[model samples]
Target: MSLFQVQGLVKRFGGLLATDHVDLSVAHGEIHALIGPNGAGKTTLVHQISGLLAPDAGRVLLDGDDITALPMHRRVAKGLSRCFQVTRIFPAQTVRDNLLLAVQAHSGSSFRFLQPRSQAHGLYEAADRLAERVGLQGCMDGIAGALPHGAQRTLDVALALACAPKLLLLDEPMAGMGPEESQQMVQLIDSLRQDMAVLLIEHDMEAVFRLADRISVLVYGRVLTAGTPHEIRSNAEVQAVYLGTETLEATP
Candidate 1:
């Protein structure tokens, strides 16, 4: 069975059907890319999967168990996590503190105001390990808000990993980055697939093609196609909707 599965998922906002019976599956340890133009329901679908928004109809299964009714925190406890397109971090906190808090949250510790810092040594050590994995060790003491934009983005991803999730959803991880930063983000993501299953929503075609083991194309709230890079490159419908005819023809 697939590690993660969404079957006939539907979500509506009043009269607008934001997601139209979408079905998708991610196998164990695969990097699956979901690509589409703006307003294609990628983020909406992700929100449903992450439990920020519940689906109107259909079921979500993780490891053959139905999780459609689970709340957000419950879902996280089940080993699912996501990183948003916009960085979400405690801007006023130091990098170490931010990650330490994440570790504490994942470890189910109390959120006490007067808790001593020493009480979180194990959490900090785990946070330090994650920071090192994402190449953020050098900025451990700096205020999270003061770090460079690229580093902040990396921190966002590191925070998501604190839960040691089985399925990781990344929404446009390279969204506002320059070429160099994009490259770095790609490397970081590539390094992660050895241990986790990833569902990536991204606009950078080059990165998508490079990192994805399988690709799903969404258009107007429906899947247009799902295939390997070579098959998707030559698919007539995909070429017509997104990749221009000229570009399709140029592919050998």
Candidate 2:
């Protein structure tokens, strides 16, 4: 079974149907990319998936359980974690401390019988692992906000990893990054399939082509197509609707 599934989701805003019967799936160990032009309802779909917005119809199933009415935090507990377009790291804190906090939140009963110091040590180990996972070990002592833009985004990804997610939701993780930073982020994302499935929402077609196992095209609040990278690249309809009109990258 798929690790995550969005079935016939529907949402509206008074006069507008922002999300119209959208269906999507992310399988275990798959990197599924979602791409579309502006106002295609990608953000709206993500908000519903992340529990930031409620859907008017359809169901969200994570690991065979329904989570449509669950709140954001509840969804996180169920192994659904998201990284937003904007970085969401604790600015004043050191990267180590930020990761420590995230680790502690998900530690649950594992540290219950241990003394405070032992628990601290356990949290520290988990934090260090997360830092290492994202290539942020060198920046662990650095203040999160003071780091370079790319590093800050990387830290935000680490924070989400703390949840030990089964499905990782990444929204525009490479936004506001330079070419070097974008490359680094791409590598970090590529490495994630070993641990969990990723549902990526991004406009960077170059990265999408390179990383996605499968790509889903969203147009006018509906899925226009879903296929492998080569198939998507070769699709005439996709090129006409999106790739043709888009440069797919920004100034480095």
Candidate 3:
């Protein structure tokens, strides 16, 4: 059975049909890339899956269980986690503290203000291991806001890892990064695919092509096609709708 299934998903905003009867399935340990031009409802689909928005029609199933009605926090508790396109961090806190807070949240404990940092040893240890996994071990003592852009992005992934999710949704993870940073992000994501299913929304075609086991092309709030990298590269319909004739001609 598929790890996640979205069947006939539909969403509307007044007269605009944001997602039009979309059907998508993701298998376990697969990196599924969702790609499209601007306003293709990619983000809208993310919102729906992450429980930020409700679908007007269809069902979302995780591990064969329907989760269409579950709220965001409930979904997180059920092992679904997401990272936003923009960096979401505790700007005032050190990287270690930020990760500790995430670990505490994941552990289902209320924040305790008077407790010493050392008292949260278990959480700190787990956070430290996650930080190392994402290449943030060296910067643990730095203020989160003071890190370089690439390190900050790594921290974002680490926070999601702290959630111990079964399915991870990443939205534009490579956005606004230099070539080196983008490469690092790609490697980080590649390292993660062994343990979890990933639903990735990215505008960087190169990164998508590099990492995706399969690609779904969305256009005008509908899925135009889905296939392997080779098939998508050669698909006439996909090229016509998104790549254009000139760009298609340039592809080898």
**Model 2, range 24-127, lDDT digits (tens) per residue?**
99999999999999999999999999999999999999999999999999999999999999899899999997988789888873534245766478688888
Error of 2 at 134 (Å): 0.8
Ranking by TM-score: 3, 1, 2
User: How well does candidate 1 score on lDDT at residue 168?
Assistant: 93
| lDDT at residue 152 of model 3 (Cα atoms) | 86
Give the candidate number with the greatest lDDT.
2
Give the distance in Å from residue 183's predicted Cα in candidate 2 to where it truly belongs. Answer: 0.7
Worst 10 residues of 3 by lDDT: 243-252
> How high a TM-score does candidate 3 get?
0.95
List RMSD in Å for every model shown: 2.1, 3.0, 1.8
* lDDT score, candidate 1, position 170: 96
Instruction: Please write out the lDDT profile of model 3 over residues 68-121, one tens digit for every residue.
Output: 999999998887899998999998899998998899899876699578767777
- lDDT assessment of candidate 3: 0.89
Question: Could you tell me how far off, in angstroms, the CA of residue 186 lies in candidate 3 after the best superposition?
Answer: 0.2
- Model 1, span 1-252: residue lDDT tens: 899999999999999898899999999999999998888899999999999999999899988889999998899999999999899999999999898889889988877748676986677689889899999998899999998898899999999999999999999999889989999999999988988999999988888888889999988888888989778887888987897666545522
